[model samples]
Target: MKNQFDQKWLDEVAVVALGCSLPGSYPSREALLDAAIGAIEAGDLKVVGRSSWWASAAWPDPTAPAYRNGVVLVETPLPASEILARLHRIETHFGRVRIDSNAPRTLDLDLIAQGRTVTEVGLVLPHPRAHERLFVMGPLAEISPEWRHPVSGRTAADLAAAATVGSDAAPDIAKT
Candidate 1:
């Protein structure tokens, strides 16, 4: 499903920043935002747009605390490897410890998509596993519902549709 699209998007659109908030040892949103902004600034991540929303009550991991996540649109001149490396640096700055795949985090900065470029060396464009994650799709839909998967040629709506938990379960994750 990823071969139909043109590669022009890569040269034009290099990076899109997506934000996720989690139960962290950090003090508050201001601190988290500062950490994120600092990373973007140091790595020269252009802030095209940004928005925040509390986590609904679905609570995927019953043992984990709720999260308030957001999305950011960015354009980076660096390649995926460099960008990912920079993102990790920012994550480290925020005290993001990788305990497990869905472990609670202080701040998770995911590289949702990098134009139409797709690779498996380390980073996957259009996020290889994006089709199955509601956490990523919900905030993304807010940013660009029509944003097409660069490689798969699938719309954000498609990925949202494929999410296992119905819309009913999402509100549970968003905090009021």
Candidate 2:
């Protein structure tokens, strides 16, 4: 039983990414990168691609401030549970809180997509709201502009354009 379980687990795959947002505890991109790189090095994950961008927050949460965010693409041969566990550990290490859905976080590591498979176990892939945020789109578009969402068949760019409901000047940030 143990050997069978181990082999099954090793056959899994996950889509992973590194995203940075501020008012985070860390200051510069390098600082965030250091933390991200550290996590990747410590885990059974593969670094596929990465991108970055900046956007002001929408008004519903007035207390929290604007955020500068980024995206990373990672490929992992670990089960979804293992991938999420690792990401959760990294987020906790970076001081992320889960008080609310859109609450501010120090370092956010989300599983954007996983091998074209759709799941609702404990996580969702092509992240349910991924297409709805510019920060996500800007970076994803940078890396996977033509990458189609398994459910919608729309490109990352299309989702960014459709879900954006606010007006803010694009910040001076490097995306990709």
Candidate 3:
């Protein structure tokens, strides 16, 4: 029996912004990123574009290992729920465990947005907290500066700029 979330829709396109990070000891950033790309490819998601890694903002713990963050843009026909499910599966594939709300892990994949869709039950499109996180906005701005918040109508770059104010975490783009 196929999972309900696995059911496919036809010709739907979603502009997905994914924020990826790895905390604690694990595979090299390059390796983990490669794995993510591989997983997206295997899932038949079209790679629209991606941004270079950036230093992650310290949240919940400022002393944790520096995290490398980046965003990927994909065109997928999957529903918002299934897209989120796929993201969780990718996280699990990279050894993520749900120990706590913001615990460090080998991989963290967030589904930042699914076009204009929005829901708070199982998954939230345009991510409920995305507008306030530099980690999400920075890379997202790099690739999709014009991308607007569904609710606030603020562009990704605008959100990123606003988030930088008074932020102790100075995120720098990773040199590839």
Candidate 4:
């Protein structure tokens, strides 16, 4: 029999992005993250764990306000597309308006991955470029160091240390 059967448990894990630079309706990024987590918990998924919120200078424009970013692991039976849809809805509720490529937003939620599903035509798995960003990989590594990239088979910790983007990213010491 094939070994490493524990990997099967990851099938139900859905990774979520908690990123925000604008306060919007909330008083602070922490409040926004809290509200987003509450909304997520109200969905079909069950929030299981989370990573430390990391701070990074805004991308494409370092002069802009820094961003607070983190990840959450949820257990769900929902498919990748459905999970993405739900995340978008939560973003809408948080007053996120899509304009510029990486404009500051109250909340930005992305379904980084759901289990090991991978697709190119629709919602891409492993978030396509997430592995190259420290902001994403770092937090993910904090929670699931061994989270494997379905395509490359690399662990999150490895990816985080090797990330090409957000070199200044680090776990927010004040928040953590």
Candidate 5:
């Protein structure tokens, strides 16, 4: 299920994965996401592709409010550290609190991967745990099914189907 976008430039630039989600309304998740995307676009990166917002139960706590999640593909020239710093700034600008881990926040931005680059230090590339989460892989598959994990070399669609985390994940019907 390849998306209808021309991804030929994928080889010409470094592709960075961006995961965005909102479990709490900060004037509506969609609005906040739009603004966040704009902010990302305003930076030194260029957003080349995106997945439609998907809805899923709050992980580890299904009783909590559902989350609207999506993945964006951006081309960047900055190092992985700077790219992560920019993401953190965007998350903070959107009212994201760092105290509670996974406790329903206004905005959550994650750097899932950056090209084939990998690091063992603080900021991990091709996110060490991303391969286990469908909420992340599902959207990644949606936009770039041909994407492959840098280490395992598995396609986005492959890891997405084999994903263990967030099995209940699915396309957001409310959006379509």
Candidate 6:
């Protein structure tokens, strides 16, 4: 029998990394992380790696509360759009209300990458800003040191290193 498969709904497995951060008082940093992990686990995403929490860099607002940031790597069968939607759902569950860009949020979940697939219209693959933010690169490098940017071909470690060199604004990452 010939293989029967639907190209439109085929499961596209991808190694996805999510950059999570929170700058709020309602849900503690640990609580936010636990909730995220719970959501990921509920979604049946296989947890491959995790990074230590770090303080957020002062961006868009230097006076904002110190944001705790981290990254999680998961092996998922969901497409990029579904993965992004799931992340948004989790954020909503955690009281994240998107009112403005760069606003102090209770939860911020960014879909940093989805394997090597590149799409720019609705969702940009290999996140456009991942290469520049140490907050994202630091944790990403810890979990996926060998992972390369699909567009730039630079390893996560390299990107993290570049983000830190001569940049006084780099986030202070604390080793836990």
Compare the candidates by lDDT and give the number of the best one: 4
lDDT of 4 at 115: 81
Ten-residue stretch with the least lDDT total in model 2: 1-10
The estimated TM-scores of all candidates read 0.74, 0.74, 0.80, 0.92, 0.87, 0.79
Residue-level lDDT of model 5, residues 17-63, one tens digit each, is 33335534556777777778898899798887887777778878888
| Residue pairs in candidate 4 whose N, alpha carbon or C atoms collide under 3 angstroms | none
Candidate 4 accuracy as lDDT: 0.83
lDDT agreement with native, every candidate: 0.59, 0.59, 0.64, 0.83, 0.74, 0.64
Please, what are the lDDT tens digits per residue for candidate 1 over residues 68-132? 55555567777777777888887887778888766667767777777766565866676666666
Query: Total clashes, candidate 4?
Result: 0
Deviation in Å, model 3, residue 7 alpha carbon: 28
lDDT value, candidate 5, whole model: 0.74
Model 1 alpha-carbon miss at residue 2, Å = 27
Model 2: per-residue Cα lDDT over 1-176, one tens digit each: 00111222212334354544453556664476457757775767776555545455634575675555555555666766677788888887777788875665566777777666655587667677777766666556665566666678786657666656323524335532
Q: Could you tell which candidate, 4 or 5, scores higher by TM-score?
A: 4
After superposition, candidate 5 runs with Cα above 4 Å error: 1-26
lDDT of 3 by residue, 106-129 (tens): 777777776666554866666677
Distance from true location, Cα of 34 in model 5, Å: 1.6
Ten-residue segment with the worst summed lDDT in candidate 4? 1-10
Over 4 Å off, model 2: 1-25, 165-171, 174-176
Candidate 1, position 167, lDDT: 44
The runs of at least 3 residues in candidate 4 whose Cα sits more than 4 Å from the true structure, single-residue gaps closed, are 1-6, 119-121
CA RMSD of each candidate after superposition: 5.6, 7.9, 7.4, 4.1, 2.7, 7.7
